[model samples]
Target: MTSALILENLCKSFGSGADAVQVLDHVALDLPQGQSLALTGDSGSGKSTLLHICAGLEPFDRGKVVLAGHDITQNDDAAGAALRRDTIGLVFQQFNLIPSLTVAANLAFQARLAGRHDPDFTTELARRLGIAQLMSRYPEQLSGGQQQRVAIGRCLAARPRLVLADEPTGNLDEATGDAVLDLMMELAAQAGTALLLVTHSTRLAQRCDSRVHLRAGKLQVPA
Candidate 1:
């Protein structure tokens, strides 16, 4: 089967000359459709940098990023933005929901941007995330877990082929975090969306189909 996401010899750097700092050094990875992979590492180990590169949010100095059969690594900014809007979904630890938008509006935001808004799907996701009753509420009115659910729901509403999560459960209590992770995995599986999750929790990483460790800018197969 064709991979849902692939990265080949990925390399990224920041600064220049004497100040140059390499974040990714010839990193490579692939995730088949419907597969889930967890990325774990210490602070500044390139986990988030790799995630950003995969999501087309950051440019790589050298490498290829193919998502859902499109090689978007070299696409122009506009093309990359379009590709990301159409094929990629990202969830961050901060639950970056718009404060002025209601839960339902936030859930529909990405879908609207992608021009693939499906009322039925958004409604179902809201219900599944247990935010249906709070659809009219603003982000500020909800708890941290509730806001994160809305964030997840917003991503799912886009029906993205690949989902990138960065420390998605990092802000929640243990019970809430587990519950959210479970819901995310279940939903991603049901949608056949490949998931690349960067997390620090060993238990969470173990729940994925594969676990990888990143250290000193290199990735290793979990022992």
Candidate 2:
């Protein structure tokens, strides 16, 4: 089967020769459709950098990144933005909801941008996330957990081929985090969206289809 996301011999660094710090060295990954892969590492281990590369938000020095059969490494910023707008969903720890837009509007924002807006799907998704009641309220009106639920909803609104979550539950307490994870997994699976999750929580990592640990810019199977 075709992989949902792939990275082969990926390399990345910051700065020029003298001050350059190699962040990723020959990293590789293959995430299949409807599967979740957890990325774990210590601070400054390049997990976020790797996620950004996969998202096509950051360019790498060498190697390949393919998403849903397209070579994201080859895309220019405009193309990358288009790809990200259409094919990928992102969930961040901070729950980057628009304070200005109402919950309903925020949820539909990206879907609209992708030209795939579906009011029916958005309504159903909100209902599924248990945020249907808050549709009229602004993000600031919700709790952190509620904001996160909205963020997750927004990610799924476009029915993206892949979902990249960067410590999605980091801002929540253990119980809330677990709850959010359950909902995220359930919803992503229901939509057949592949998941690439970056997290420091071993429990969260263990919940994915597989776990890969990062250290000093390299990847290893959890021993």
Candidate 3:
């Protein structure tokens, strides 16, 4: 079976000449279906950069990144956006929920955009996230943790081939964070989606199928 995600000699840099700051160097890794991989690194270690590059929101100067079956490193912006819309789910530190839309609408947004909307899946995901009762409610009406659960439901409801989360539980307290992470892991597994999660907490990272560290712009299993 094809890997859900593959990074081969991925390299990225900013600026130019002497001022050029290389953020990613020959980074490589893989994520298979129905499993989670934790990405842990110090700030400025390029964890988010790698995520953005993988998501096709940013371009790399070297190497390749394949998402699902597409080679994202070769795609232009339009193709990248399409891939993101059709195959990828991103959970950010900020909930990023639509303030004007009801929780149900927000949950259905991406799935609809991908032409993969399933009312039953949306309902089930909302229920699993513990936000089914809040479906008709607007984002502002919910607490921080509630909004985050809605955000997670939004991603998983789409049934994306790969789920990329960058500090998804960062804004919540420890207990809430743990609960949110647990829900995300369980939902992703149920959907058979590959997950690449960027986090700082070792306790959280240890729960994943594997853990990788980013340093000097490379990814490696912890020594």
lDDT of each: 0.88, 0.89, 0.89
Minimal lDDT window, size 10, model 2: 171-180
TM-score of each: 0.93, 0.92, 0.93
- Measured on C-alpha atoms, candidate 1 has an lDDT of 0.88
Model 1: residue 1 alpha-carbon error in angstroms = 1.3
What does the lDDT read for residue 153 in candidate 1?
88
Clashing pairs in 1: none
- Candidate 1 lDDT over 133-188, as tens digits, reads 99999999998878888898898899888999998877678887887788778878
**Which ranges of candidate 3 are over 4 A from the true structure?**
none
Measured with C-alpha atoms, the lDDT of residue 138 in candidate 1 is 97
**lDDT tens per residue, model 3, 1-223:** 5699999988899899999988898888878988899999999998998898889887789899989879986787798899999999999777899999999999999999999999998898777667889989999999988888888889988889899999888877988788778888887888788999999999999999999999887777996
